[model samples]
Target: MEVRWDIFLIILGSALVTFLPRVLPLMVLSRMELPDWGIRWLNYVPISVMAALVGQELLLHDGQLAPLFTNLELMAAIPTFLVAIMTRSLLGTVVAGMISIMILRYFL
Candidate 1:
């Protein structure tokens, strides 16, 4: 077997680049105490990111804003959002979303 040093170095460098941004913050922040407001604000980050992703997927088509009335994914999202809000269960929300999309696709 031949080992390609160039390919190996590229893979190692890519891994370092990918890993440092994620780990460096944790390493630096672990020793520092965050303020209560800072921690509270940080709690919204995950949901904000998730909303951005979901909103983009649901509301856009071909890089343009999709019509809300005619979009099948948007229709499916109605029940999925309700299930997520009501149950607050990740597994149930996922299952509900999957089922909602499946039914909407199958019927319409």
Candidate 2:
């Protein structure tokens, strides 16, 4: 068996590059205390990111805005959003979204 040192070094460097950005922040922030307003502001980050992703998927086609009346994914998202809001259950919301898309694709 032959070991390639160049390949090994490249893999190690890639792993370090990928890992540092994620872990360095935690290492630096774990010892510090955030203010009340900062904590409250941070709570919105996940929701904002999720909304951006979902909005892009549901509203865009071929990099252009999709028509509201004819976009099936947008139609499916209606019930999925309602399920997420009403039940607040991740599993239920996922199931609702899957079923909605399946039905739409099968029938239309």
Best by lDDT: 2
lDDT of 1 at 77: 90
Off by over 4 Å in 2: none
lDDT by residue (1-108, candidate 1, tens digit) is 999999999999999999999999999889899999989999999989989999999999999999887899999999998998999999999999999999988998
Candidate 2 C-alpha lDDT tens digits along 31-89: 88989998899899998998999899999999999999889999999999999999999
In model 1, which regions exceed 4 Å deviation? none
| Candidate that would win on TM-score | 1
Worst 10-residue lDDT window for candidate 1 reads 67-76
